[model samples]
Target: MAKDNTTAGIIVRTYMVGALFLLVFYGVIFYNLTLYTEDRNSEKRLQLLSEYYSEKYDLADFDTIQIDPLLTIYGDYSNLPDTLSAQFSESWVGATTFHIDNDEEYSVLAQRIASASGNQTIYFVEAIGSVELDQVDIILFQSMLTGAGIFLFLIAAAYITRSARKIGGPISSLSNQLEASESDFSPINLSGHLPDETKQMLSSVNAYRARIKRALHREQLFTRYISHELRTPLTVIKGSLSVLRKSGNDKTLKHVGLMSTSVAEMEELTQTFLLLAREKLDRDVVAVDEQLVDRLLENFSGLIQRNEVHVTRVLSAPFSLDAHPQLFSAVINNLLKNAINCSLGGKVSIFLSPERIDVIDNGVGLGEKPRGYEGFGIGLKIVNDICDKYGWMFKLEPNPSRGCTATVLLK
Candidate 1:
């Protein structure tokens, strides 16, 4: 899933987002931990004072006020003022807070140290301002720690960002180089300054490129070999037919001309197949010199008659196209052949417009394209490739009338 998104985006978002969460989590945890430590220390101080004073000042000697270096002991509940009494009543063991002076408060512990004298409430007051000062130091430490963590994180992020770009830069460069090379069908080259990993990747790409070039070389050789081999026989046959046309009777001359035409078309098809393989045509553009609909229908007349299919040609105007006749005819022939093959003695309509040509057939309507039709399928695939090379729009869709429509738009 991460592969679908950009690499840099994922890296930045994941790292930055995770860092923020960690900072927040740690800040809360550290602050609470400091507060907990302060509370525990205060409790310990109160407990020690209570133990020491309990040993020295017995319950029988319950004095109202007993001063010490660390603590000011208050004896008996009734001795405390009304307001102080109310405040002390609310104090807990370790978290006790009460006023020591008008402006200052002390954190202390309340306890009942009893003996045979009677129950007496005593306040073990801690020395003033210690707990408040600790709290101030904790706040300052928390701020400094948070600032330091942020500074460290920023430095780490900068380092990581630089490192990512360094590592990812060459990879991105290699990828772009591969794309450009593939698009132009050229060799890929990487700079010698690249890192070892990048060098390895470039080596792999170059090896793959070599393999493709070799395969293409073989294909071109085979095409040339087959075309030369076939042309020799075709040339001889055409010569023989030309001679026969001159010497034979009128009916024989007609048959010879048809044979000659078929031979020529076959020769053109051989050249077309070669051009398709090379993905380059001799002519970039050609003007329409013949009625395309009439030519195609006449060429496939025999097939139409055999299949008992009705053909209709509807033209808005004399159709104009910017394509070589041979290539255009090949495309039309493949589409027409497929339509005829799929239809069961049904109608095949050829609609010609200023911008497009549509061959629609009331047939099987493209239901599960039948396989094992390689000879015909390859021809159609070549047609599609030609259309793509020429930047023409080709679409095949099922028609509402239980048929399929193949549209070729010249743009």
Candidate 2:
């Protein structure tokens, strides 16, 4: 971008322009003040010296009088211009000032003072060409300094602009990536290490990307799960129809009831899936169905037997969770798995109340667990995320009696 167009670039350009204006104004004022003031002072000093000489010395003794190097006195002043001589001859003033032009490089200022004797006219001449030459040198020096200042400013401005672009590059790229279609969504990977603020912004962007990815994954999984769940009931209904065809009229009612039960189960599962798959949690109000826990335990029966772990249940009857069943099941599954793994042959306690579920185990506490414990595992992380999504309170802390106790308080 042009230096005068971008935000920082414009600021630098404006400052440089203002500085240049100030420099020019200062140079003009300085040059004029010094030049005119010096000229006036010099003229006054020369006039005083000429008066002293006229009062104290004869015309012949003018050569003995002290004078400035740039000044000279002439008692036999005969080479004046015709017009100037005529003017001075008629004028009755005590002194007259004149500018004399000649072939020499320097201009001369001649002040004529009438001597004590009327016949002699004394001329005081001063060369002022050196002052003009010094003025030129002063202007050149000021110009050079101003140019150097502007050059350095441009370099600094360029560096600042480049740095700003570097800092914003990652964020800009992330924004472009986010603007893509949902199907085209992908992880954002920034190339190099950036400043802390930019890094934080990139982290937030990546977090948002992860959220989108999870939501999409859930969408795909929901579709697959719905199809899979529907197939079981469909197969049951088909098998029952085959049975009805083979059996006599007495068993016809049994086959019909079987088909009806399959249909009812499919409907229930569908409703559950729909509730769990919803994007918003505003309508979530999961009532505790007694069969929900029965199904969960039945599903985990094989794992329970393999682990050879004793289970103690203190669940309140007619309980419910104020959350989607799928999400609640996930949280329970992760916590239960972690509790079982940490139990190490010890008894695992499952205490449930109207508002919360507590899984207490007598295994090594979180502090004593190895580095790769469930604290850093994907399951525990998912459990935490689910709990956070539904505004549930979850804590996996070390129990006062022994190992860790996992608690999930539903809102």
Candidate 3:
């Protein structure tokens, strides 16, 4: 079983421990008070009997006298019980108690009386079996005290629980609201009387929300401006490349083709960046068809030829994913580019299925970058972000033999 670590649980446990300590404290005080009162009354009774006996009879005439069945008087310490005799000296003058048997208890008092001859000491032993509280009475009193303590504890526990709920409910609701919020940056709404601490927390959360909303708005504006600024140069370059291609010079045609490919790649990246910058995507689904893959492959065909890397594809079936075309293209393009770069002069394979897309390479594997090859940079980061936004699983693991396999689970 899991231990309760919630605020309410902690408060309730602390209160119970404190309550138990108080109960024990008061119980000890009550027991001591009862014993104190009994001892005082016994001493008074013994004093009164000594005064009456001294007025009625001679103090030094007898060594012992049985005044009552429960009371005895001794003129000196020599005639007292062994337990009583052990406690008194010539100057001792106070009350004490001793037990003769398991159930027999006696309260003894020593007093000095004035006689015609000299000062005399007398001992009064009183049987207090009925005066002192019995075991059953003590147990019953403790039981009642315990019962009352438990009853009060239950009531207090109920109140504490209710108070804890009152304190914890708003915080819990705030947590759930934050978790449920995806792109919504509106302030959280909580309905109830809230504590000051909770109000402070809510204020902080709303402040953070406002900051995030402002930052995202700035990001969107920045990406839009960048895309807008780059498109003009891209358009001019594209127009120049088209004019060059139309020229009847075969020597410059290859250079123009390369420039055009580079321009196209830059344009695609701009679009992908703009799309990624937005807080939300349009409800557009793109088909992951062979034609799209073929186009992307064709875009990188020059690099593949230059590197002498063999590329293979295993498109079992066509599938549609709920994502923007540019974003999905960016993911595939980055993955393919990484695989191609890593597997220079080697093999790069693409496996597409309804469940996932696997891009396998058998060249440098992981952590081994060729000359001029930058390690998986912003490309994989973008891929990972896209996968997370789409709730897709992306994994890159080293193969058993060589290289690594990048798998994007679409299902």
Best by TM-score: 1
Which 10-residue window in model 3 sums to the lowest lDDT? 81-90
Model 2, global lDDT: 0.64
Per-model TM-score on C-alpha atoms: 0.66, 0.34, 0.62
Total colliding residue pairs, candidate 2:
1
Model 1 segments beyond 4 Å from truth? 1-21, 56-143, 183-189, 192-197, 242-261, 279-298, 312-328, 350-359, 364-376, 387-411
TM-score of model 3 (CA atoms): 0.62
lDDT of each: 0.73, 0.64, 0.84
Select the stronger candidate by TM-score from 1 and 3. Answer: 1
The candidates, ranked best first by TM-score, are 1, 3, 2
Local accuracy of candidate 2 as per-residue lDDT tens digits, 1-411 = 434454445555666677678767866786777656656665676678667766666655253223666556655546543544554553333443344354122222344445555455455655554543364676787788668767876786677667656655666666666676344556666687667886787778778878987887888687668767787767777676777767748577665755655575455445544544555656555656556666666555555666667877776866655676666776776677777776666778877777788988888778665334445566677677777767878888887888888888865
Give the RMSD in angstroms, all C-alphas superposed, for model 1.
6.5
Off by over 4 Å in 2: 1-278, 281-285, 367-376
Question: Candidate 1 on 72-109: residue-level lDDT in tens?
Answer: 67665566556556665533334465544553556566
